[model samples]
Target: MRRVERALLSVSDKTGLIDFARGLSELGVELISTGGTAKALADAGLPVKNVSDVTGFPEMLEGRVKTLHPMIHGGLLADRSKPEHMSKIAEHGILPIDIVVVNLYPFAATVAKPGVTWEEAIENIDIGGPSMVRSAAKNHAAVAVVVSPSSYDGVLNELLRNDGKLEAETLKRLAGEAFAHTAAYDATIAAYFAKKLGEETESILPAKLTLSFEKAQDLRYGENPHQKAAFYREAQGGQGVASARKLHGKELSFNNIYDLNAAYNLVQEFAGEKDPTAAIIKHTNPCGIAVSTTLADAFTKARAGDPISAFGGILATSRPIDAATAELITGKNTFFEAIIAPGYDEDAFKILTEKKQWGANLILLEAEFGAEAAGENIDIKRVSGGILVQTEDKHAVGRADLTTVTRRGPSDAEIADLLFAWKVVKHVKSNAIVIAKDRQIVGVGAGQMNRVQSVRLAVEQAGDKAKGAALASDAFFPFADGPEAAGIAGVTSIIQPGGSKKDGETTEMADNYNIAMVFTGHRHFRH
Candidate 1:
């Protein structure tokens, strides 16, 4: 442990600067600052020496040239462990800085602003702050680095508890955090430049990908009870499931987070639509999905798709949960593990929180914002030795993208059902099949071994409802058995990608069975 005698303080976020400086002053520590930070400390009635005063040079270039002098860095980098290192700094009339308090400029926040110019974003990037942080962190055996306002209280408490000295372990932890803070800051800058430089769509993946994350929470276990797990949130774009605010119920488990993320993502697919939408997900595949005139009706119809699977599953809705919707959800004895949405009406919140059964344990997460879409338009999967990266499957087949392949064209109602089923199938697992009627998912067969098996599974689930329903296959059928199964189930219309050698056979079968078949020309295969 080393006694802290001097602290260099220069930060863009001055959250706890006053209180922390006062605490250090009480410990007989000298305060050194730059520019606005110096002015703020002096205004707070704390004695502070300006960096220009210490270096005997004035800040230049519109305040960008402050704290770049060797006087500041040499003090932070000096090794007190060596007698010569301390004597050399003293001989040069330099005082060693024991702590560095700094936080970089808000490059991420500035770039996120609407209509922000390139000049503004470039200006917000801090050069000297990161340099000072790195210098102090690199010499953390003797120096302590503080990079966030949130660390002020704990650091101050430690300094007071130890009579102005920080333990070696504390120094190491602070240094690690300082490095991560600078890394995340630099990563944000690099990504912004990549966007501004306009990398061609053909070169979507960068030569090197640097990702930064911070631990959000530690879970009880992972996918299985025996596995360890934790949640790490992205440094930038702090939205979606990672940013969700839990309004009620028990803490989220590992599987609960995954299911909530799945439900949240699928619900975002229908954002800003005319009708209210709801989806229930089981094991990351949505079992029930529907859009209806009313929020209550949407939830009711969605649950009707597969109430057995919907039990204890994750539920998500497009709009806020209204009183009627809340009543409908709790009306049945069935229970859901969690529900995520934009918000909840006051009455709805009360009813759900105070429900008769399973209410106390039901997790309620309120997104509270637009909850617009999935963050980061790319997909990443871990493999045995390396990783696979691909662009997100955001493609949607509009009505104009459809081509009638069979002799009979789908009726207007069948077209609506086909489009609805098309959207749902894209989110299901590979070899997926969806049966929809009147904008409600009647059945979903996902992750089957073969396309024909998926078709049969969906038809069986739909039962009587399959008679007039529209079916959507995520990919083209390799054999006519899929269409033949749909035909025997009395399916009236079908939508698929239609790019197989046996497309001729499938088309012939559809024509023979009077099933209106259309090719979307796009395959949505999820794995």
Candidate 2:
């Protein structure tokens, strides 16, 4: 244990400062502070010595050069066990500082505000605070560093119990926390600068990538029941599953959250439309999706697309939930793991909670939609040894992006269904196939190892409904087998990226079957 005789305190967040300082003063420890902290302590009737008196140098550069002197750093960094270090401090008349408490300026909060100038942000960057923290943390055996107000009560209890001394283990833990605090602070500043530079140069990738996340929840288990799991939200706040508000139902499981994310993202694709859109997700893949003039119709068509897979699935909509939709969702032979929408009417909420017994187990979430949704987010996937980061796949195939390659061109109605199927296929897993008619997905095959198998699965699921429906592939067909399978299933049109070496063969097969094919020149492969 190391006894704390003298301590330095400088903080931007002065929470619990008075009580903590008073406790330290009662223990006969000398308190030294700078600037506003010193003034605040003195006004509270506590014995406080100004840092200017200890260093014998007045603060200059508008209080920027207050604590950078040798007297301050040497006092904190000197090794008490070393005879040479003690002799140098004694020869220089430097008093040893046993504890250092500091929290840096609010650089993260300052830059987050709108219309913040570079001059203002640069001024908020702390230098002296981080220096003292690192110095004390580096000499953890002889010094105790405190960086958060949350640790104040714990430290005070320990100090009181140990007669104003801190244990070496406690000091080591505090030092580790101090380093993490500085690391996160520096990462935020670096990200801000990188964004500014990228905007000016029109560059997408930064020279170095820095990310920070805060723990959101600890789940009961991971994908499997035996694995550990936790949820983390990005330090930079945005709208999505992470920002959703739980309105009803039991706690969300790990698999439920995963499927919720996939379902919500798929529904957001129709945010700009006035029509109601519904998407059903199973195991992070879209089982059914539809858009209609009414929410009830949307739910009916979406659920009809694949009733077997839609059972116990996650349901998401681009509009509010009303009475008619609530009744359809909670009716007999209909069940869902979760329901997500922008809002829920009073009658609808009551019916969902009181009318159906199974509703108690359904997770209900209210999320932001349309213009309020998050903008231009990054997608991250963890591989075996590292992570792969890329910009989100937000590319939508417009009329201009579609190139007619078949002898027969697509009709207006077929073109609309092609666009709708294209959007749904983008969210499906790699080697995906989607068949849709009138903006409603009739069948979807996802995560297959081969493209032809995926197409066959989708066509088989569609059955008689495959007639006159458009087909969408996440990527180009490697051979003519995929298009031939779709043609045999009675598919009227197909849309895919046209970058494969056998694109000519695929086009010839489409022409032979009198099917319309459009090339998007872009592929979406979600692994």
RMSD of each: 1.8, 2.8
Tell me the spans in candidate 1 whose CA falls farther than 4 Å from its real position.
198-203, 368-376
List model 2 lDDT by residue over 1-527, tens digit each: 46889999999999999899999999888999999999989999999999999999999999889999999999999999999998999899999999898999998778767678989999999999999999999999999999999899899889999999998899999999999888888887887787677778776458788877767889999999999999987666567898899999888889999999999989989888789999899999999899999999999999999999999899999999999999999998888989889999999998887755787787889999776422356688999998887878888879878999999999999999999999899999999999999989998989999999999999999998999999999999999999999999999999999899999999999998999999999999999
Q: Against the true structure, whose lDDT is highest?
A: 2
Count: clashes, candidate 1: 0
Error of 2 at 484 (Å): 2.6
lDDT of 1 by residue, 1-527 (tens): 57999999988888988999999998999999998899999999999999999999999999889889878888988888899988988989888999999998988778777678889999999999999999999999999999988889999999889888898899999999999899988887876666555343544567666666678999999999999999988666646898899999998999999999889888877876888899999999999999999999999999999999999899999999999999888886678999999999999999999986788989999984344432345578999998888877878877888999999999999999999999889889989999999999998899998999999889999999999899999999999999999999999999999999999999999998899999998999999
Model 1, TM vs. native:
0.96
Maximum-TM-score candidate = 1
TM per prediction: 0.96, 0.90
